[model samples]
Target: MAGNSDPLTPRAKIAVTAGKAVAAASRAAGRGSGSVIGGRVALKLDPDLLARLAQNLDVVLVSATNGKTTTTRLIAEALRAAGPVVSNALGANMPAGITSALAGGSEARYGVIEVDEKYLAGVARDTDPKCIALLNLSRDQLDRAAETRMLAENWREGLAGSKAVIVANADDPLVVWAASSSANVIWVAAGQMWKDDAWSCPSCGGVMQRPGDDWFCGECGFRRPTPSWALSGDHVLDPHGSAWPIHLQLPGRANKANAASSAAVAAVFGVPPQVALERMYQVQAVAGRYDVVQFQGRDLRLLLAKNPAGWLETFSLIDPPPTPVILSVNARGADGTDTSWLWDVDYTRLTGHPICVIGDRKLDLAVRLEVANQQFQVCENLDQAVQLCPPGRIEVIANYTAFQDLRRRVGN
Candidate 1:
């Protein structure tokens, strides 16, 4: 395994120093955190910067269509029980971002990386992580990301061999199929709320027979593996059948599921379930996903939901009806150009709540809500939307860029 004593090449050392300079300049200019840009410059100068920086770190890479950022945060916190841990806690999942994070924390004992779904293979190859947590797979960024099954195939092939312990979600057939080829895997029955993408078997292209939680291929007999870790309502059951109540500051069942995966990965690093869960409980939010801030005299809760699967999960986290909900979306480079995924979401669930649509793509969302027979006002901006809502706590659910815009507006 790579260790901190392994010195970087002279070229890599220069690249690292230059990257820091660029990042500092970026932050000084208020252009955004300089992680991505800085990492890009470092990679341009020294292509092997990531592998060099990862030396001497017990790395853990977390990837999924949703919840990876939060799960990454939880796992990093849990691993801190062992020693100082470095992580890309700012939602920077790409190579450039991951490189910046690793370079910044050169002396940290562990690296907990939140990897973008498509870049998992490359990052894993470079980091040689001690543990790789594969959460559920689903359709996201349709215009940019690969098809759901194709990405599964990429994961299956990319991780065909090697020694990293694979912590996978058994509840997701896509995840199970991808991780099955690995020799060392700890399967967790992490709940998969959005099942639209896994109706067929990735193994044989046959119809999947999901009788309750157990799933199998009708043609090839590919079946869901018995999970060593499972979620039992409000508690997570370990391989020994001991149940641990998940009391987290992060709301919703999705977060509880993330806790299960994080605990499993933390265990690989010698952090027991009791200690891991206790450490994870401290993470109240991930990159401002569920942050609440006072805006225009009303408490505005920011919730991020980028894809259809994400939208389903975000809806469950909203404050109950009569508490007005603001839905915002944007079709920017960050948030895939395609807006068709909006139709896949069951927006009727928001019918009872006072709804307001605002964002670059608010008109597109308004049409979807209209089709769902949900009455909503199209606001030009968040200020106007908040002005119409009654005083007190209000929910604001937004996609990628829209969420960032709202976070900036609220100064969160």
Candidate 2:
């Protein structure tokens, strides 16, 4: 006690922490240990021991410009129809993140995660997944993710030696390039003629016609082989519906694409197409994608906007701008470090006055609306926004993490 010294230095503390974490995890694996959330266990975990319990562990990984969350979640559920699975339900797909998630789930025969674009290389190195699913790519988060194609190139390098069966969207130009070098790549084509896929030659930027549902570049012989799995459709069901004769927890055009992605992966696991499609049709929408909330006097459409692709998908689902809408930006730099992505979102698609601006960067959204020439109000606080919401009807659009916080505020 005579001389006070730093009891544990930073390096020592890290070693001690990792040791404790691993020991705790090892103990937690044999027993189902979890914390309470929204008054439910919410998720289940068991760590490495639980993963050791699984049989024939054929892990699947999904990466995308859009659809990662909904797609991965759907794949997890579909796999449930087949067997046990270990997955980070919250899309934590980094190296340390995946290690923690996989180590936590001890009772799984498969592992899956919705990986971030920039973190793919690290996660792939750690997991070496057997079945990989890749979706589309688009310009998003230029500050953090340089460019979508650059990220896609990195994905190819990460998957080069992986002994995993790969599923790719054949209509995407970048996806075509990524799958070119992989021997186990299973190409899937979803028949969305909309602007989602690459219909033009990458070299000349001229429209490359699809001859018989197969894509080829007219400007150059740069083309890819046909996909192993495919879907043909227009205007798939919207997730906003309360329930369907065929229940899909996640619904919408992008969701349809999400379902197709899950189906492709499930098929790779030897799950029959009929079984996967049935699973897709049977799920209902989750909390985020166009989740509709019924408040005391208001009907709110809670649309999630994180990246440009997500917002674009949201806009595609909405017929027209819902009047008297409220937009929330979690500009605290908490959810995402950058709030400038608002520049990429086409807010002009909105046609009416925004009743409230919610979140720490409330003014940022308010000002952005002004710059976009859209009329809006600044409630500043979320409660104030809730109070000011049009009594009968209103739309509320929130970004990733903000959406959950907003839902809790409205008791949704």
Candidate 3:
């Protein structure tokens, strides 16, 4: 409808037009980005709107418990080396949000979507993507979403006969099991830092034997696949054994792992590793993550860690001792309503820093910190939390809703 060369059906055109108007109204009212509500409206009007919108575009779907948004962003950037790309850049990865993104970028040659872990199969079905990148899977949104093994089974069943090339993480036993049914797959040895959720094999329910960089199930013989693409320290080793150094602006080993996966996905679309990585280096942030903002005369570096696995990776990105880390949390609908994940995080690693906790569920985190024997001060809000820290550079690690709240407060 916008600039798409392929004309939408009359009914689909009307639905998309109504969706765009609602989305614009949503933004104008300061409610939020109208992507979700707008897409919902469009779907209600025409049930097949998503598939219609995705027609004629080469699509790539990326799903994982962690790093999906950043990986989606990196893939979009890398694919730009080929042509214009459309993506849900604001971390809206559900059906409605994805529909809105596709509708808006009707003329783009590529559609790189960040599909939520629970919704991956459905999105994959509708988009019929050329490639699907499955990053590591772990427990996230446990109260609302399916368990890790169940999710893996869903993925394995959903992708059984798909023609799409799957770029999967071989380091995660769960992911390996999930993508095993696919006919064509490019295995990437993307490292998994949080191994708690995958200690058992999804294939046989046997205890997984992990030795160094290899994993195998002695009971079932379901071992780690030999990776065609591997992450070797700071370099990504291609199928030809050529090493390409990763020098992205984003920090942490997780982003490097994401880069490895993204490079592999980009290759499926005909973009070479060196060219994809060169273009990916231009992405400084995903949504509001890793954004450094000046607040209260101090530099506040924003980081989003929504679950146990995410927290483990985020801890590695924080500044070393005396930098004053602020931990914020919330039990909103988007945050899974369960504070139990806090207990799973290794708060003891934060023992040497000046820690401040604030959010609707600050007490839950405070109690968890107390149990970990790490001291923390609970504050009423972000302002109070920042006031407790001696200025310079402070790291603020927060869950989903709390991170958005802080972003609004800091005008980031």
Candidate 4:
């Protein structure tokens, strides 16, 4: 038992017990995906299961196109100062996953949940979170999610009725527009590396102008809000111009921005930036983001890049020129059946580097690289690719299912 026992109705209690049984059976069958199916069954048996579990809980809901899982993990770590915080540790962002996390941690009152962009409003309605953090929005799984602008518009309407204090990215035009109508908002300039999805104003359907570091609509008055908290390189800057240096075991500017966004949300609950940033530095790996493991007599660092925006940021973190890198991709159900998004990523950035292409979509990725005028070697498997790399740490970047396959092989 983890918070006080939830005050669930007798029927809801039966549903929870049944779901727990299903979860245990799934784990026993070597399908330990952390309550996904079990939670789904419970919710089907009782559609109001989440609302019941979330009672008397101070919950924080985090949503973004990228960095939702990592940001949720970072915020959970920082929120430890408040009390035990329950979260979807398995990268499950939907209602079932949220239910699983809540049911699994029955004794924890404080909670944080990473929500998929399209499902945020639904989950928020059920959970009634105390705070909502909006990171950057970009085109992801376009086959399934369609356009980023459409998603932002949905958020704007859905969030209008929410009472939660919103912590939003001031640099992202989409994020600014989504949370503009919130009753209370804490804006943070965590930086946006992907701007293709935010080129237009969602409000007026007009082109936006970026002068210096700020963006404003030419037709509408919508613009990038001045952040109460901003990130300056590795430093977290305050509204008064004072700054605190942030250290992270994870690499890249995107992660620094993720940390800054999490820190901003933590401040709303009385956790200071210095304390939050200190705890964040201790996170070397969130899920499979920056995990180094030995496989096939070679050490490898695992990084997940699901879409174009993610690949751009991951490539930026890789060392330049001839560093042995392994890029893997798959078009499984979890990775979206449409592999066309591969063409959207800038694979040319790795032109001069030694890259070994592997996975189910290896042919698709290879074709993309070839069309981009980049040179790469095709490998039969992950172990073979790792063996081809020079001795020592080989950076392995993989999409959804491909990364999971590697993790299982490495016993991670």
**Cα lDDT computed for each candidate against the true fold:** 0.91, 0.63, 0.92, 0.87
Task: Please give, for residues 73-192, the per-residue lDDT of candidate 1 as tens digits.
Answer: 999999999999999999889999999999988669999999998999999999888999999999998899999999999999988895799999999999999998899999999888
Residue pairs of candidate 3 with colliding backbone atoms: none
List residue ranges in candidate 1 displaced over 4 A: none
The deviation in Å at residue 293 for candidate 4 is: 0.5
Ranking by TM-score: 1, 3, 4, 2
lDDT of 3 by residue, 250-281 (tens): 99999999999999999998999999999989
TM-score between model 4 and native: 0.96
Which 10 residues in a row give candidate 1 its minimum summed lDDT?
1-10
Candidate 4 lDDT by residue in tens digits, 1-412: 1246556998888888888899989989998674889899899989999999988578999999899999999999998877788999778888898898888777676789999999988888998888999998887775688588888888888999798989999999988988987888999999888777888888898999988788999897988888899989889986677798889998999989988888888888888888999998878898877898877777788999988899999999987777789999988888888998887888888887888999998999999999999878899998788777876578899998999998998999
TM-score of candidate 2 against the unseen true structure: 0.75
Clashing pairs in 4: 2-107, 3-107, 3-108
Summed over model 2, clashes come to 19
